[model samples]
Every structure is written in C-alpha cells, then in structure tokens.
Target chain A: MKEKRLISRRRAIFTGLTSAGALLLSGCLKKAPPTYGSILRLGDDLTYLAQRGLLSQRALVMEYQQTDITSFPVTDIGDPANPASTKAYSKEYEALLKTDFKDWALTIEGAVAKPGKYTLDQLQKLGERTQITRHSCEEGWSAIAEWTGVPLAALLKDAGVLASARYVSFYGFDKYAESIDMLDALHPQTILAHRMNGESIPARNGAPLRLRVETQVGYKSVKYVQRIVVAEQFVDPAQDIQAGWSWYNGI
Target chain B: MSASQTTHSETFRHKGWVKSAHFVITFAFLALLVSGYVILMSHPRLYWGKAGNDLTPALFELPISKNYHHGGWAKAIPFKNLKGSQVSAARTFDIFNENGWGRSTHFLAAWFLIITGLLYLLAGIFSGHFRRDLAPGRGEFSLKMLWRDLVAHFRKQSSAPGKYGLLQKVTYLSVIFFLFPVVILTGFAMSPAIAANYPFLLIIFFGHQSARTIHFFAAVLLLLFLLVHVVMVIRTGFKRNLWAITFGK
Candidate 1:
C-alpha cells in the first residue's frame, strides 16, 4: 500500500510539473502568432547555422581581395564619453585624418610584451587581407561592407598578445565603446579595417580605424578606433550589462 | 451564480467543434505565449524600430529581405542580425532568425487565438461558462462581496457557488473575451506587414508602436488573469475544476 501511494504521489507531482510547464510555454506561444517566429527567425539564422552548422561553410563568410576595397573615412570616435579621451586620442587623431590618415597610427598597449605604435604604412606592410563580411546590427538592420586591413591575429602576433589577456578593449573616435574576448580578438575574420566599399571609408563611417568583428552585433564593432588595450580582465566587468548589451553576442 | 431558471448543477461541456478548437487554440496560443515572449525579451527595451532589431536569433527564425531581391525568384531566408552599418549583414546572434518569421509566427498564432477566441465568445453566450462561471450575481458586485471573496479565498471559507461565483465570471469575462481581443488587436497594430495588408486596422490601432506597447501589456494582463484563474481553481478544488474542464464529472 505504501509503495502504491508513493507511486501515485510521484505521478501527481509529475503531472503538476508538466501542467505548470505547459502553462508557461503556452503563455509564450499565443503571442503575435506562431507564424512570425516561424518565418522571420529562419532567415536571420545564418549565424546560428554557422555556429551550430545548420549547413557548414555554405555559410562561410565571403572573402575579398584587398584591392577591391576603398579606404574608410573617419566620421566618429569609438567612445564619446570614455573618460580616457585625452590618453586615447591626441591631436594625431585629427592630423592623421587631415592627412587622409596616410600618417595615422594604431598603438597596441596594456599587457602586451611588444607594446608598440604602428603607423598606417607599417600596418599595411604587415600584409593586408580583405574579407567580404556581413555586419549585423542589434536594431534589425544589416549591411555588406568589404573591409580591408591587417588581420587581427597578425597584429596580436606582432604585439605578442599576453596569454592572460581575457579581453581586448577598443577605444574608438565614435561615441561607441566596446570590448571583446581574446578569442574573438584573434578570430581569423576579425580585423582593424581602414577601408570600405572600394574607396576610403567615409568620415561618417568610423574611418581611419574600426574593429570588424564578424561574430558580434554592430555596436561592438567600435568605429573610429584610437587605441586597443589587451587586458587579463574586462575594464568594466559589467559594461555590456550596463549597456544592456549581451556579453556573448557570438553569431 | 444564483439559482434561477438555469439549472443549478449544470456542468460545463465542450460545445460544437470546440473540443478541437480548444486543442488547436491551446497549442497555438501556448506557442504564441512562448515564442512571442522570446521576441519580446530580445527588445526588452521597447520602441518602434524594425521588428528584426527587436528579435533574437538562435531560437526564432523570422524571414528577412535584403539587397533588393525582387519577387518571384526573390528567395526568402531566415537570417541573424549581422554586426555592421551595412544594409546586408550576414548574421548576428538574435533570439531568433529573421526573414520576418517571428512576427509572422506571432501574427498567425495571434490570428488563431483571436478567431478561436471569438468563436468561444459566441459560444460562451450559449454554453453559459461566462454566465455560470464568470458573471457575478447582483450581490457579487457589492464591496461586501469583494471583501468576502478575499476573505473566503484566503481563509478558505468562501462557498463554491456550485457552478461559479461572481469572481469566476468577472475574471473569465474579462480575460477570455475582453483581454484576448485587445492583445490580438494590439499585436496587429504593431505589425506593418499586417497593417499594410489590412489598412483598415490602422484606423483601429492608431499606429504600430502604440499597438505594440499596448499589445505587450495586454498579454501581461491576460497572464495575470490566468494566475487568478489557477489560484481560484486550486482554492476551490483542483480535481473538481479539472473534472469540469475535462470530463465535467
């Protein structure tokens, strides 16, 4: 009798759990209708397909030759409110762009063995590579911009990215500021682009320098980069949280 | 409910094709509740922007159009929001994929919920769940009755009006009929695809964003109502209520 009673109790608990689970799920199901989820979510799933491989390299990012791209114009800074503005961008910021960024330089500082400032020519001479990648935004807009620049891995290799560096914080001339995991920083597709669309990047487009992160949201791309600090930890651990952005915006 | 010309012990029964409709509506409404919520979570900071912007990618699959792919051969695809200022990004992680599918899913499910809800509403007029289960008798509306219900519910002292009392009817009437329509209407209002297809709805909804915000709250209200419904059922007797819904024993 005790065994029978226990079985009945277990069944009751199981049914109750199912019912509650069903209730929660059903509540979400009756929303804007199911077709919206079915139709739209499918198209935007290329990243999911790539990451999860709904279909392998059929989802491969298109590649382009550096010769096919235009130089990106400097329009904005990476961080509009970043307190480190003075230390981030000096007069060289304007002078570089004024000179068509022909003399602009990018410095990899903080926690790297070979912390050095790289001039534009120096960066290009490091071996330029181009990739035709899609930039996906958080706001539901997308664009295809061919980006040409030194591969992030190559740059990190030059600076000797520290083994303990967990994140690479990017400071840009645009109002935007962001950081990425070292893993993303070393992604083969991730680059510091100086050109776009077969011409110099427009000033409005984060010209002179921007981080092209193919795996994350547009907000994290950090246009108009001024400096990069590879660190063992986040400058702001809750930066993404405070910004209401996802820390893991992996495609 | 007061004993009147109506049968006092009249048990609720599923009428017409309501059994099938119930299952379909239940599943569809259930799905809407879930996937719709996933989309909502994507843009928890709500504003009138592109629906694609507001959704997630890994879980949902909304269809999106890019690069002026004209119709006929224009292949619709599910894509993630990619990272960039360019108009055709390859992919960014959203709660779901976008080819305009999440909204479509939400709309289709909402349409089903609304249509079936209307049928249930009409049916309620004849079936008496509204009358028997929800409508509070003359005494039910009084402040005293309200206090008594609160006390009875908490203290477990209230009498089960045999069929339903004032609380049950008012809750059901507001939730099943009133709230469902409002949510569905609000959802339609927020959808440009729907509004463009059905221009007349624009007049009713005023604008897309307005409908969106209102629709979100309406869902919340329905959820609240559902909570009350469950609480009351459990309070009254889970098995008895379950019997009424399933077997009406």
Candidate 2:
C-alpha cells in the first residue's frame, strides 16, 4: 500500500509540473510589448492591458500648485556635469547651445502632409500651455515642476498629420529617440516644453525643447527634442529596449 | 494499533489546492525579495511627501552603498532657507544602477504572487479553511493560553502534530488578512499609472514616497515573519511538515 501511494504521488507531481509548464507556455505564445524577455514582456503586457482597461484615456494625472513644485533634478544620463555620458549631445548641439538655440529648428516630417521646419519663435506662436505636474521616475524618485510649452497635438495639426499616422516619434539632437501612441500624442497635457519654472529651460533640463508626457513615467518625456516624426507603424526606440527598459512605461 | 492508524490518517492536513498555492506563492515571494533588494540597491534612500530626489532632503537614508551624498551634502544658504541636508547632484562615485533585470523580475513575480494570493484567499474563505484551521478557536485568545504557547515556543516544546497552536493561528491570520493587503495596497500607491486612476491610494498613503517607505517596512515585516515561520517548521518536524504541505501525506 505504501509503495502504491508513493508511485501515485510521483505521478501527481509530474502532472502538476506538466500543467504549470503548459500554462506558462500559453502565456508566452501571446504577443506582448517590448521588454527584456518573453516572460517579462508577458508581465508588461498584463500591466499594460490592466491599466488601459481601468484608466480613462483622457484622464489627467495629478497637478500640483506652484508652491508644491520641488527641486527637479536632471537624470544622471543627461547630467551636464558628465557631458561624456550624454551620448546624444554633439558638437552641433554645443554650437546651438552657444547661440541659445537661435539657429535651431524643429523638423516635423514623416506621414505628415506638410513636412516643414519650425524655428523656436514660430513654434511658440502656434499655442502655449503651462502645467505643474509630478515627474515620477521608475527609480522611485519624483519631482514637481511647472512646464510651459505648446501642446504636441497643436504642432501635429500644424504639420498636417497624414491619415496613415499611428505613432508620434520624438528625436533629440543627442540621437536619443522615444515614441508615444496617438492617444498620448493627442493628450492635452502632452507638450513640447520650452520653458520651465518661468524661465527658458536650462541646458541641464533639456533646454530649448523637450517632450512632456505627464501621464507616463519621467523617462518618456524625452529631452532636447529636435525632430518629430509622425509614423505609420509603431516606432520602437531600439536603445531603450536594448537597455531592458519597458517600451510602454505608462506608469 | 488503533492509535497509530488514527495519527497516520490525520497526517494529510493540507488540501490539494492549498498545497499548490502555497508552493507557488513561496516561489514568487522568494523572487520578489531578491529582486526587490537588487532594485533597492540602486537607490537606498527613502523620503516623504510627493517629491524627493538627490537635490531634496531625505527623510531616511541607508548606507548600504556609496550612492548617498557621494558628492557631499549641499551647503546651507541661510537666505534661501536651505538646511544643507540635500544630497549634491554631482556624485564622487557612480551609483549602483543594474536594476533592469531586477525590475522585470519584480513585476513578473508580483503578478504571480497577486494571482496566487487572490486564489488562496478566495479558496480559504469558501472552503472554511480560514474559520476551521486558521482562526483562533474559543478560549484560544485568552491571555493564559497565549502565554502558555509563547512559553512553550521559547522552551522549544513542539505543539501537537497536525494542529496549529494559538500563537501560530494568530500570526497566520494577521499575515493573511492585514500584512499582505497593506503591502499590496502600498505597492499600488507607488505606481504612477495606478495612482492616476486611483488617487485615493495616494491620499491614503499620504504620497508616493510615503507609500514607498511603508512598502519597505511592510516587506521587512514579511521577511521577519518568513524567518520565524521557517524556524518553527524546522523546530517542529521538518520532514513531517514538508510532506504534509507538499504531498499532503
């Protein structure tokens, strides 16, 4: 009787392991967002789906008052103190910085009916919005700051976005790039920020232009933006994915 | 012979589903703790309120690594009302920053833990396991009984085989009902997306940083509970306990 029981127990364990493996394999079969591995990507997909289902598309993130604004620190990767680490910044950026971006122009191209370059002065003339919102980083730190800029949707409309456009990609002068879905691109809070805290954005804080995706993590707000591309397909920022960062960091 | 048969029959204490959930959550918890530590090593400082960073004053700091104030604290400017407590943005040393895998593992493990925990909770309730096995029975909550259990534990006297003592029941109940829920809620509060949808989480926790601080403490408590639980299992009868929970023998 004891031998029979032991054999049955071994069979039960085998069956349990097999079923668990099958379940995991099924999860792997589903297409997921870009992450480090299939398992991690599956987890990201679950989070993305759950958040998308629960959160309102138009719901705004929390906004604080001027008094609530705190000391916003620049990320180490973009630290002006370590210019060598800022791989995207080049000699061209240095020249533009010397003239305070006077010669700089933001190019809007790809999937746009009227692809054109707009100087800083002309871009600001399109529209303007200011908001005090918290910039939450994935590293468990956050800061609140007031940002002033023109809404990205305004820029896209001005460029006459084509019907084929599905994603908006932002490219920095330093070669860093990031993209957002049309939902976030059209978000009222999403803007191409030019000024921070009532002053021209400091060089340490992405200077003349940066994308402010208030609803997502701070990293999604790519700084030093020089070009905007409306894309017909999902534009994957290869660097971020290669570094194992989640493509859709909604939170 | 009759007494031996009765004891043998009672050896199978755990239900099949309970054993499965227990093992799954155990694996997930282990993954979470290790990955959580790796993530924390990247930035070991804790703060209060909505915003905190290298340029802000930290409410609490851990010296696990050189990440804290590597460039030295900022000098106080009396006119500016600065207290010189903020960490300087310039760092003398590079921060520990290999947390990409850690984060992915943490999120993945968290999903497993939540699913398994929810299943265990629903099953425990429906199956009367919480009432019949986990809950303190009549007279079990009495001070005398609790004290007796505590004294017996200190003396390393094993409780009855296949039965939980008063102290065990209370600890299990608190862990299941209070501690796990608090930890999960505080975790959600830290997520910006979740907070955007559920602002009440932020309001309850006082802010993002506060939620992080609370999450850290709750995790520590859970760690302590795990240690004590493993010790108790070993002290009682490692083989018997393992067999009962694993094969439900």
Candidate 3:
C-alpha cells in the first residue's frame, strides 16, 4: 500500500510539471516579443510586459527637489580637448560648436502633416516644462537633475503628427538615434530638453537640445537633437539589438 | 536487527516538489551567479545613496578587475548645487565590458529563480514542509542543543544518518526566510521602471545605489552559503543524499 501511494504521488508530480511546462511554452509562443536572435530576449519581453502591467499609462516617476539634484555624468561625450576620443564628436558638430550652435536647426519631416524645420528660438517658443527627476542608466548608476524643455507631445502636435504614426524617432547630430512608441511619445514627462540645471545644456550633455525620456533608461534620452521622424514602425537604431541592448529598455 | 532495519528503511527522503524546486533553483542560482559576476566585472565599485559613479566615492570596491579607480579620480568641478563634485568622464582604462549577454542571461535566470522560489514557498506552506523539516521545534532552540551541534561541526562529527542538526535547521531557515527574499527585493529595487511605479522599494532600500550595494553583499552571502552547502553534502554521504533527492526514495 505504501509503495502504491509513492507511485501515485510520483505520477502526480510528473503530470503537474508537464502541464506547467506546456503552459509556459504556450504563453511564450503567443505573447513573447521580438527575441532579437537569442532566446534570452524572451526575458526582456517578460520584463517589458511586467513593467507595463505594473505602471499606469501616465504614471510619473518620483520627482526630486532642486537641492536633491546630484552630479550627472557625461558619457560618450569624450574630452573636449581631444574631440577625436569620442564616437559622437564630428567635424560638423565641432563647426556648429565653434559658433555655439547658431546655425543648427531641428528638422521634423517623416509622417507629419506639416513638415518643417525649427531653430532653437522657435522650438523654445512652443512650450516649456521643467522637471527634476532621476536619470537611471543601464550601467547601474542614477542621478537626479532638473531639466527644462518643451513637451514632446506639444512638438508632435505642432508638427501635426499623422494618424498612421505609431513610433516617434529622434536622430541626434552625434549619429545616435532612438525611437519610442506612442504611449511614451505622448507622455507628459517626455520632453525635448533645452536646458539642464537652469543653464543652456552644456555641449558635453547634448547642447542645444536633447530628448528626456523620463520613463525609460538614460540611453533612451538621445542627445544632440538634429531631426525628428514619425514612423509607422520602430526603426532599430543601428546594431543596438545586435550589440545586445534591449530596444525597449523601459527600466 | 529487525528494529534497526525498520529504522533505516524509514530514513527521511525529500518530497517530490521539494526536490523539483531544489533542482531548478540550483541551476538558476548558478546562472545568476556567473552572469552576475560577468556583469559586475564591467563596473565593480559599490556605493551608497541615490546615485554613484566612478567620480563618486565608493563604499566598497572589489579588486576583481582593473575598473576600480582606473587612472585615479577626476578633479572635482562645481556641479549643480554641490561645490566641487567629481566629474564622471575620467575613466582612463577600459574594463571587461562584454556584459550584454550577462545582463540578458541574468534577467532570464532571475525569472526562473523567482518563479520557482515562489512556488517552493507556497508548497512549503501548504504541504507543511517548512513546519516539519525546516522550522525548529520550540524545544530545539535551547542553547545546549545549538552548542552541541557547533562543537560536533568543529570536530567533524557527522549527525545522525539523515536527521537535520539544530545548526543546519537554523542556517536553512535563515537562508530561506531572510537571505533569498532580501536579494530578490534588492534586485527589483535597482530597476528604474519598477521604482517609477513602486517608489516604496526605493524608500525601503534607502536609495537606488544602496539597493545595488545591498544586492551585491547578499549575493556574496548566498555564494558563501552555496559553498558551505556543497561541502556539507559531500562530507555527509554525497551519494546517499544525491540519490534520495533525485529519486525521492
């Protein structure tokens, strides 16, 4: 009788395990996002889904006081004395820098009803929003800063974003580009920051204009803004996935 | 002879679900440790408070890589409100930065660990595994019993063939009830997206960098536990324990 009971219990355990495995496999098949070559990317999908589920659509990140702002890092900007040290530094950027970006203009064209170009003065006139929020990096560091900018939604509205647009892409003069979905595109906290800590953004920190995506990692906040493109689908920004960074990176 | 045989036959065997969870947790933990180590190799300094970088003073620095104090500290410059803060763009040496796969694997293995751990917790509660096997009885908490176990451990004296000693029970209980949960919570507290939605985690951990520092220490403790656990298993009839866990016999 004892042997029989053991057998039944073992059978039950196997049955339960098999069912659980089947359930997980089916769930992955149905709901898994883009795997980006490796099966481990499914974990990224799980994280994305879990975070989205937990966060309300318009949930705002914790804001800090001006005194709470910390010393923010300037990554990928390289030494100003040696502009060749960084990947983002270019002859064009150097030339623009020489005159304090007097001739630089931001172009908004793709999938917009009104394609146009705007100078710094014009972009600043659209609207102003100042927020002091923590900037979390993928490298396990975080710093709080007060950023002043025009809401991305305001810019999109002014540019007359088309109904078919699903993603908004930001291209930087530094050759870096990133795209965000509609949810983040319209988020009140998302802005094209023109100033940092009450001063015009330093060249080391994306001068003239930079994208502030408060909902995501710091990398999502592209710097040195040069153009904006509204698109139907996300354009993966140059080997970002192949290089093993998550495209969404909401955290 | 017959009585002894009966006692031997009735030796404790781990339950099926317990064995299953243990198997999954072992692999998941190994994955977490390796991937976590790889990720740590990229940036090995631990700090406290809301933010930290190479420029900030570290609470602890691991000597595993060249990333620690690479080329000394950058000179402090006047930042926002603070007078003379270190600039963060002064790294002189490139450390091991191939941590993309590490990050991916770490998250994946973390999911497995969390799911299996939660299931184990529920099963332990529902099946009375925690009560019967892990949790020490009221009488077992006596100092004499603990001292005896400690002395025996020092002398390399093994306990009864399959019984848990008072020391074993306490250690296992602490690991399950405290260490694992702390590690998982600290891990979640480091995520910006999670913190955005649940600021309570940040408050509980004190800050983002604090959470990271705590996570590192907890992981180190867990690794130490794993080392001791393996050594104990090997010393106390490795084949027998392995067979019992694998076959539930």
Best by DockQ: 3
- For each candidate, what's the DockQ? 0.04, 0.30, 0.38
Candidate 3's C-alpha runs over 4 A off are: A1-33, A77-86, B1-11, B72-77, B80-93
Task: Give residue A22's lDDT in candidate 1 (0 to 100).
Answer: 100
Model 2 lDDT tens row, A1-251: 34655458778999999999898756643434455456666676677666766688787777887677777665535433245755544677778898878899999999999999999999999999999888888777888788899999999999999877888888876667888878789989999999887778767678789999987888789888878889987667646666666667774
Better of 1 and 2 by lDDT: 2
Q: Which should have the higher DockQ, number 1 or number 2?
A: 2
Report the poorest 10 consecutive residues by lDDT, candidate 1 chain A: A68-77
Model 3 C-alpha lDDT per residue in residues A1-251, reported as the tens digit of each score: 34655458778999999999899767755543467667677777787767666677587778887666777767643443246667666677788888989998999988899999999888889999999988877766677888999999998999999998978888887788888878889988999998888778877678889999988878889888888999876576645666687767774
Q: Comparing candidate 1 with candidate 2, which one achieves the higher TM-score?
A: 2
lDDT for model 2, on a 0 to 1 scale? 0.78
Q: Arrange candidates by lDDT, highest first: which order?
A: 3, 2, 1
Q: Candidate 1 on B129-229: residue-level lDDT in tens?
A: 55665677665588787777677656555454455555555666677667877887665544322343354554565433345656767877877766776
Query: How high is the TM-score of chain A in each model?
Result: 0.64, 0.82, 0.83
Question: In every candidate, what fraction of the native interface contacts is reproduced?
Answer: 0.04, 0.46, 0.48
TM-score of 1: 0.42
Runs in model 1 lying further than 4 Å from the true structure:
A1-92, B1-249
